[model samples]
Target chain A: MGTWLALVASLNGLAAGAFLLGAFGLLATRQMLGCVRFFRLQSLALVASIFLIAIGMRVPDLIAVALLDLAIKPLLIPWLLRRYVREELFRRREIDQLLNIPTSLVIGLTLTLTAYFLAGVLPPAAGAMGNINVPIGLAGLLLGAYTLAVRREAVPQLIGIFAIENGSLFAGIAIAPRLPLVAEMAFPFDMLIIALVIGILTRITHERVGTTRVGALATLREGAPK
Target chain B: MTLFVILALPLIAAIVSALPLGRKLAPSATLLAAVASVCLVGRAALTVAAGHRVVAVPDWVELDGLGALILLLVAVVGTTAALFSWGYIAREENSRHLRQYYANYNLFVFSMLAVPMLVEPALVWTAVELTTIFAIYLVAFDNTPEAVEAAWKYSILTIMGGAMALLGFIVLFHAMRFGNEPFTWAGLVKLAPKVSPEVLESAFLLILIGFGAKVGLVPLHTWLPDAHSQAPSPICALLSGVKTTVVLYVILRFVPILNASGRINVDRWAIIVGLISVGIAAFLILQVTDYKRLFAFSTVEHMGIILVAAGLGGAAAHYGAVYQILNHSLTKSFCFFAAGTTLLAVDTRQIADLRGLIRTSPIAGVALLFGGIAIAGAPPLAVFLSEFSIFRSGIAGQHYIAIGLLAIFIIVAFFGILHHLNSMVFGEPMPQATPMTPVHLPLSSVLTLILAGAPIVILGLYMPSFLHRILQTAAQGLAG
Candidate 1:
């Protein structure tokens, strides 16, 4: 392979690897602040990858996407989380975690390996996207789902979901340069609505039962008293 | 002209309804737009029934056979819902909450009308998601703690599911991008055969699971009962009738593509999920105590039956599925209307709390009885004919297990509904008089009953050529 092409490929690989690594760390961390930091790092890595792609393909859209990632992921979302943390005064660790940090880390590792292997098995229709970027994307999906299943706090779970969205976004960019701007715009709208709804639910939870822990919602079980 | 009118009328009405002047005129304004749109949709349906597509606004929006069928649904039900909301909200006008209720009601109808007409898939997603956001306010319209809670749960759960749907769309976009087509419905349909199987499989699964949540399929239907029970009666009718079915239409749009891809046996997966959903919801129907919830579970049950029909994967079953869609939308909306009226007179939704409805309000009692008989698949009703066709097709396919289970569940659920209707509508009156202001029953309620009820009666006895053509085209599109 040409030297320039090799360098571009290496940068893409490094960016995807960084995203996968940060996803694992986010899933492994017990502290909410720690999770936030890991997610910020993952976003930073995403920015770097987008920058590389823009330079390589000379596409302005990739650069625009990079700016969006830089603005929303590292800066805005974390600020929102910090403010929510202070206002809710929720310091107690989240309860009802389905798995511990170690087991989750192991699962995350297995997912990353599976992602890599699965990418190899896929028929290569998407050029570089089908071969390299898909594995990292799948890893991000698995990790995000894991976080969704295991995390007890609403904020962290939301962050995990954002990570999964980012992963899919990156995969789309890598595979198809002409992805519909409308669909991309819809993602943020969806995120904004989800965050708004979750914020409202958290406030309701605090007012009603004095905590945002979802475990308390078990009172509405089937055949239970009204 | 039709496209712009269909798209803009509701939105203009919604904005007008938010104004102080519009509040007084909201009902009439909304009813006007709805009636106009229904007439336009009926014309579009006829055009398509003649084997010519309604390509409105050129590339931006078009009505093919599938779109026409759905537009007909949105227009008919939307008009009825608007008419019902006039009286329904007037009854609440004495309360401080009436203004916001009318505004949200307008927006909700606007969103539903937009869903089936938009030709772009991404635009359709936006419209569908907008419906959910508008509904959040409506679900919590009463602003009680339970109402607020239900609204929150419904919004959060559905939005989360929408996130998955967005991912699916992105995947499909990528798949189509490589094949020299844009993200329009026509583009996707043209390029679907050449799209990679891996991408097709992932996209189909994601779309199914995501849209399935909105359709109230099993494992994602936790919000239906709460949302249905809490929302205003007319809104409940819309929710169960047009809203969920439109989402199902979105999912059905991809079935042909997935089938043609020759990758990922989607039929088996659809059938399996459909059967399980049908079986479980049927049992749960018997266990529900709230009348609205009983109706809500019935919505889930009917959705399962539709999916099962769609999964059977032939022209006959496909037609049956389409027929079921029409029957379910009309019958379910009528059921909600009746249930809402019953609640107004009885002042409670608890099935055990209602009795002697026939003594208290004969109009409402008979509506409830007819709705019950129609929804329970009694003979000479639309649901009976459609469901019988589905079962016959299933049996023909040697799907004995599915047919047997479906029969058992349908019979069991019917008896459960029958028991509830019998006790609530016929028994001795509850001791307390809940004295409610009797607002004049709007022409819409009577109209909705006739519009929905007449089809059930007419189609059961005689099928019209135009209706049969639309169903045939829709079925052909589904089977691909």
Candidate 2:
């Protein structure tokens, strides 16, 4: 029992470490592919955490959840991102981010601290698994939202959005390990479909207007100007 | 059984209608599928009215009075939209786009129906997200520059909201763990009192804002007008009429659980956001130039009113809100179909270019005039009756300030819509525009306009015993 508890704690620690690393990497990376690769790692860590929790809690059904995450998140999403990049922005690999890497990293760290502070403020619920997981998960969530706001490219924005999902999944696993297996299964499928739809929309935008910057999509308004 | 049929039939129709054989007979196939679903809805409504709830697959799918009310709305509007699509889309696109359009349209209806039917909270959120994905494709069906852009904006903004809502779901699911209850609506509501107050409060706020964004609440509604104006007219009718109501229903589903929390007054947040949306959209309506956009902003305003009604926190307010849902769905859809026919007749959506509409297309012009009046909450129309109930509930609940503010904004919106619509219907015809051949209105579209309008007039003046009973039950159910 002691060994199992230690193992669970260390596994959750590893998951939080991976999530924070990916979030900081999101701030540090200029290449769209690199950001997506970080998301893949974050999702992989989340899957590992889910497996650890399943093992610790003796709930075998979560194996399916881990497998679904592995199939959709680390494998399928990254593959789709690669294809989207090839199709939409053939020559461009780097995103011209709104904030420079060093400054954004500083802000990302501050967000992590803010997340810790915010999580500290919440009165702890009884059934939560570990103290560190919620705060770390929140850190990932905040960094992910910040990345979405700061990134200008479409693919990076998609990555940021996926990062938010990863954070929530991590928090959800730690806080509610007994969440219905069906609900857990549905999350990955929804994210997969959303990624595919975003890919299709990006492809269309690229082919028609030769740009995938969200800032460029400001033409529609109240009236057609004379 | 009936619940599953109401949910699954449209999805199956969407898939089957995507096939080559089905594409060739898309309109008839879609109409048949829609009619079949309406039959199922009628059956389910009967079940609910008999004081029996349908629980399909245990906790995953269920329908009670509130669900039944929304199901009936989706069925009626969906059938009309399908019929309107036949006449409105047939002449506008090629066979390939037509097939894709019908498929997406049906799938869109399926997702909306799934929201009100699903009992599991997570699955309900999934269905709501599915609605946006399916609808965004339909929004961009035209492949025009404006259409693509609008679809993209609609996708990103609403998905962002969906993601936040998912976060709330995660928190709520975590809270449910405290009592070892299932993560369904009934389970969560049953467990609400045991959950930590702090967690419940945060979850409620996150959810209200998250789904609130999709409901086109102010400051998150930049996508509403763009998507509405750029999409084909039939699709716009569904987006404004059925889609918004369905999302709001999802929001309302959480009301019982939030009420049970015993730690927070969630209605205040609803009232605040409701007031802002109504006030902002009402003022913004005066500045819109596109006729379709004008209708779209009116949707935003009406959504605000419904939210205010929901926020008022009384049995009567809940009743009024559900009744308003039905009224807005019928009247707004008729207005969009009328706008589509008007666009078809005149070949433009610009308000400035659509002068003397009565001279050009008398039926469509008259439809627009009356539909506009119905939407503006004029007397002896469906919206008027519902809005009156909302006001009475607000006064009774002592939400005097909110009611007063809502009254002012609603009147402003009323004149704003009436001014634009009246000019288009009654002003002199555009002198510079060339006289064109009179376009014949499709039989399906005429039926849609007449069918949608009939309920608005009839239900306003008289309510059947069964409907009144259902509304009362739904309102009571919503309150607890």
Candidate 3:
């Protein structure tokens, strides 16, 4: 039993490390499609972490939550995006960021460290697996917010928002593995709706503005000279 | 069962409105559903007011005094907005997809109704997100580039906030789990004392900033004026009037729970955050160019006031808070309805271009002026009474600094709003404008202005004993 527990904890640690890496990839990647790829990677890492944490914690409910994340985040959301978003969105690279890649990476590192220190403000995690999941999950969340701050295109920002959710749930799996199945069941469906709405919105924005670079779509502001 | 029916009515109406049966059927069905929901919700509120917790599914679906107040507000605004939309959208868009607009409208109403009805925090979060999803198309209904742009901003920002709030709810669940409580608001309050300060504080802060964005609190409120201005006016009425309040209702659910922890000064945080929103919104209202945007900023101000009142944390302040919530929702909807009629009459949103509307359209000019006075908290209006009660509560509680800042900001916003409305309603005619011919206002909208405006006028003069009881009960539930 001890060896099995050690195995699951170590695997959870490895998946969490990969999850942080995926978040960094999302921050630094120049291509919109690269953002999607990194997001999928992060989601897969999340599934692995949740599944391993379920095993480590002996919570069967989390296994179902992990499966739901697996199906929706990776498989279904991307498919819906592809179906709804224009083909050109994939081909076009979003080079215009509010900050340069190197600066963003440095800030991302700082944010990760900040997350580590911030997680100390909470009590010690419930288990060995939780110790790995909580701070790393927070880093993922902070990094996701950073990605949103820098990314200019519609799709990358949307994906950035997704990463933020992934970050929270990644921590949530370890922290509140026993959350009711009813609420857990709602998460994937909510994500599906978000993808659908954003997908159609991306299409509308592109058709109207002739570009998905939403940051450039800033006609509405206060005190514009009439 | 009635709670379940309140939840299901809007869903049924959405389907009926979506059918290709003529445009008349869509609005009729939507209005019918909205009115029915309000009736059911009114019944529920009376039950709550009479000291009964209406639990549809134990720990899953329930309505308390606080929930009932917000639900009733949403239903009322949803109904008026539906009625206002009948004439507003029919003439403005005249597009082939009018049925689609009503369908989306009904769905949006359904999503809002779900938020206060559901007892589970997670389900409530889902309902809040659904409100954004269902309303995105409505925000971009005109499909104009600017409108679509506003919709995109509205969806991304608020939904991003929703994502952040998801983590907060999880943290709350984590805190609650340590104490073996059910995962509901009532359960959290009961479990709060056993929870650690750091865990509960983090959860509270995360949800505060997360949902605060949707509530149009400052720094997160950049999208509010834009989205509120660009949506069709009836939708603006609903968005500004009830939706922000609906989201804030979720935040208020945390107050007693946090206070129950007996550690974190959640009231102080509420005051600081509320004051900042009110301060910033007051200044923004001063510089606002569009008429609709003016109301949007005032929304931020009103939200701040309620937060401050809630933060003060006494029975009187809590009463003031709920009263302000009720007054703001009603008066603001009327303000938006007036804005809608003015938009139809003049065919422009520019405050500078709207000169001497009294000469061109007396009904719209009078309505706009009335709306401005009522919303600005002038004499003999519902808003004035609520605002006065809050001031009295603050003074009585000895929250001198917050009261001072709140008083200053409210005055600034009042003058700012009335100044703009005054110039627009009673100024020199802009002859250079496009012929300045008076456009005939839509009949349904005219009816809506009269229907919605009556409450603003009547409530100010007479304090109905039942509503007073309801507000008192909601305040107690809030203060715990």
lDDT winner:
3
Q: Give the alpha carbon lDDT tens digit for every residue of B1-480 in model 2.
A: 777777778877787778777344887778888999998887787778789878888878888788888888888888988999988888854677888888898889999988888888888889999999899889988887788889888988788778878877877777765787767777888888888777877777777777877889998999999999889988998899989889888888777888888777878877898899999999999989888899899999989898889889978899988888888988998889989888878878888888888987888889889889999999988899999999999999999999999999999999999999988998788875425677688888888888888888899889988788777767876786
Q: Chain B in candidate 3 has what TM-score?
A: 0.98
Query: Model 2 off-target regions past 4 Å?
Result: A84-96, A121-129, A223-226, B22-24, B178-182
Give residue B318's lDDT in candidate 3 (0 to 100).
93
By lDDT, the candidates rank as 3, 2, 1
- lDDT scores in order: 0.76, 0.83, 0.90
Clashing pairs in 1: none
The sequence of per-residue lDDT tens digits that candidate 3 reaches over residues B1-480 is 999899889888889888887768888999999999989999999999999889999999999889889999999999999889988888745534788888899889888988987889989989999988888998898789889989988988898899889888888888765677778888888888989888888888999999999999999999999899999999999999999999999999989999999999999999999999999999989998999999999999999999999999889889999999999999999999999999888888999898998878889999999999999999889999998999998999899999999999999999999899889999777876434555788899999999999998889999888898889889988976
lDDT of 2 at A152: 81
Winner of 1 and 2 under DockQ: 2
Among all candidates shown, the one with the greatest DockQ:
3
Measured against the true structure, the TM-scores of the candidates, in listed sequence, are 0.90, 0.96, 0.98
Q: Which regions in candidate 3 have their CA more than 4 angstroms from the true location?
A: B92-96, B432-437
- The digit string of per-residue lDDT tens for model 1 on A85-190 reads 4543434455457788888888888888887776543333244523466677767776776787688776677777777776766665665655556555565566
Going through the candidates in order, their DockQ values are 0.31, 0.61, 0.79
Tens digits of per-residue lDDT, candidate 1, B1-480, equal 677778788877776666676345777778888888888788888988788867767655777787788879878888777877776777665433665676677777777777777777877888888888778878876656666557655765676567667657767776665477757776777787887777777777877887888888998999888888888888999999989999988888887878877766777877888888888888898888888888999999999998888888777788889999999988898898888777766668787777888878777788899999999999988899999999989888888887898899899889988998998889887777434544345565666666667776887899998888888877877876
